[model samples]
Target: PDTTVVVGPGGSFEVPLNPPLTNGETVTVIVTDPAGNSSTPVTVEAPDTTAPAPATDVQVAPDGSSVTGNAEPGATVGVDTDGDGQPDTTVVVGPGGNFEVPLNPPLTNGETVTVIVTDPAGNSSTPVTAEAPDFPDAPQVNASNGSVLSGTAEAGVTIVITDGNGNPIGQTSADANGSWSFTPGSQLPDGTVVNVVARDAAGNSSPATSITVDGVAPNAPVVEPSNGSELSGTAEPGSSVTLTDGNGNPIGQTTADANGNWSFTPSTPLPDGTVVNVVARDAAGNSSPPASVTVDAVAPATPTVDPSNGTTLSGTAEPGATVTLTDGNGNPIGQVTADGSGNWTFTPSTPLPNGTVVNATATDPSGNASSPASVTVDAVAPATPVVNPSNGTTLSGTAEPGATVTLTDGNGNPIGQVTADGSGNWSFTPTTPLPNGTVVNATATDASGNTSAGSSVTVD
Candidate 1:
């Protein structure tokens, strides 16, 4: 008995235990009555004294930030994060017998920890061990040009590649040097971003890294109509483009603007018939197939004109070219087409006057024109001469200056010639004395090669 109580009226009394009994503890109590009367002794039992079961399946987080396990319900759990033989953290098991303990400053990777569970009655279970897993680091992705992707990660870790939608696409493993590579079954489109993660053997995944797929090359550039001196085109926005000639010589380089437009002017003009090749390169270093354009910048050859007889004119020019005739004052005269054989002819609507000049040009199909060619019209001849009667030994005449005078026999056979002086006076002595009644004839010719009608007279 722990305490005694005085008897009350009707023989009723009470006894109190000063200190509570421990789990599974027992105590015997006896009742005492007045006049030294004694009652039977009885034993009272306390709560259960069994210790909690040892924590099972103890696991430390891969990041070492937490510990988790199963234990007896309503039990207290202790964790020794540093394995120092003392608990650094504690937690109470839930009604479901599951517990989780957090570490303030996460334990180092691969660190070993100890865990124990104790019941409410103060009975402790055997210790359990858990280790913090070493998580792999994010991979370093390399810049790629095609379908193949490569990177570096922790050695012996598995690498996983996923599309932007988080769908798994491929898998590989890092080598001893931490280098890894993956090739998709099918080619990826250009500018596709893929996610990559490194997974260690313990099933711990690292933060995701990204790599952009650039398997498809850019579309062939769209070239604008250009002269040989300057080039312009459209390509992938912000990409670099290179120009080359037919002989594969580098001409120049330029970058496409935000609108995909590009232009370049060479220091020297490119010759006609140049085959220019252009290639587009994107930021990822992928080059497109060469696009080609032929240059047609040269003008047609100058035309050749024949002498005009005042009525009809003829010439030669580049085949299929448009021939245009203009006068000395640049006024349009007539237009004609050169035949396939390069032959061309032009006839004035009305006969041109003597000494009129004509100019001709040839324009090719490309609209390039040749230099002008010229010809002069000359159709009229000089005036006839005036002859004087002859003295047989000295035949004289008044005629156009520079005119030649001749003497002939009555039969119009065998003649002698002489030229008129600047004063238009002329004389010619017959090699033989002209017989009486013999005739003489004279004629004049101008610089244009036209001959005048002859004048005649009889000799004395």
Candidate 2:
């Protein structure tokens, strides 16, 4: 190497080599005083060829934006982001062998990058490899239930909630299990939309996830009239409806149809007076106020009827119930309400004919009617018979046809019995002759068993 003159402070002077000297080469230097006295020549060695150690403790930013580590002091750290065996960026190690390099177009998570350390001597160490750190993932949001919002994310991440317009609404952190929840300060109207993002400790934010809010509860259900095991109702379309007993035990569940109609049949029959409760819930799990109905499955008992007397009919039925009377042909005769004691009486506007059949039924307060009870009218009695004067041995009388005449003496002693002929005539001959002046009395009984007043004649 040729010598070149260099000027510096008194303590030390630096010399430049005209043709750069190779590593580990030797050079000779000569010094002369200001006066004419020469000094001996001295030999000096150039930098050695040994390379510095590769970067140690290398770490990449969670977002892959930067690389940092320790290296030999004064060593230059070169970063190869693409694994192409070429440095894309470099940084000089500082006093404590610490260096950090910022990367443009940062590496992605799990991407491999090569690092090499070179000292001032131009010697390079073997390349070291590092992987970009992973970042937090987007948060998962749950369906809104008209009351609160909740979901999951990476553990320890901060959750940022925003409205559909990108306005910040709330912030919270995930628990150790990556679960989180939030209740809005005020009610969100139905069909509101929101967004959520997860931010890591390194200030890196994941992509935003959009969520639709459903905040409306279904309307109260309208139950239909029912008296059997099955119940049906109307509610919000597509709502889930539940059936529960008075005590809140679950009975069954059903989903409403497009027309808002729903039905459910219990596994077992409910007893009379059992209260059934119904509730409707929308898709977002918002529940409506409960509605209730009482079961009235039992019908009134059959009425107890007395035989009709052509003009009036009477019966016993459930208290405070309505009793209706119908003829054998099912024509309405009359209706009356039973008293508190369950006794009812109905008088026809027009007198019913003898032998007319009357049927009675009682309807209770719940409008349930019992089976019919029937009775036949037999109010007329047979006419009195005419007894002819007779001797002690024989007696005769005129009575209604088809009737039976029973004869007796004036003392009320039985004489004989006889049936009337087609011409309404009857005769009875005593097995023993009656005494003189004994009175013969006759009475008539019609086919319906109605008896007439007696007529008397004196025996000659």
Residue-level lDDT tens digits of model 2 in 1-460: 2664533457467787857676778888876555845559788887778888888999888777899999999999999987788899999999998999998888775687899999998889988899876557889997786467788999999999988888877899999999998888886677777899999898878888877877767789987645547788899998999988899988889999999999888777777788889999887778999998887777889998876557667879999888988889999888899999999987787778888998889887555779999888876878999888887877887999978899887889988889999999988877788889998888998765678999999889
Give the whole-model CA lDDT for all candidates, comma-separated. 0.81, 0.84
Model 1, residue 373: distance off in Å is: 47
Clashes of 2: 0
TM-score of each: 0.40, 0.40
Give candidate 1's whole-model lDDT.
Answer: 0.81
lDDT of 1 at 120: 85
Writing each residue's lDDT as its tens digit, candidate 1 over 40-146 gives: 98887878767778999888876778889999988899998766787888898999988889977886657788998988878889899888776678998875664
Clashes of each: 0, 0
Ten residues in a row with the worst lDDT in model 2? Answer: 1-10
Off by over 4 Å in 2: 1-125, 128-130, 220-238, 246-267, 283-285, 289-460
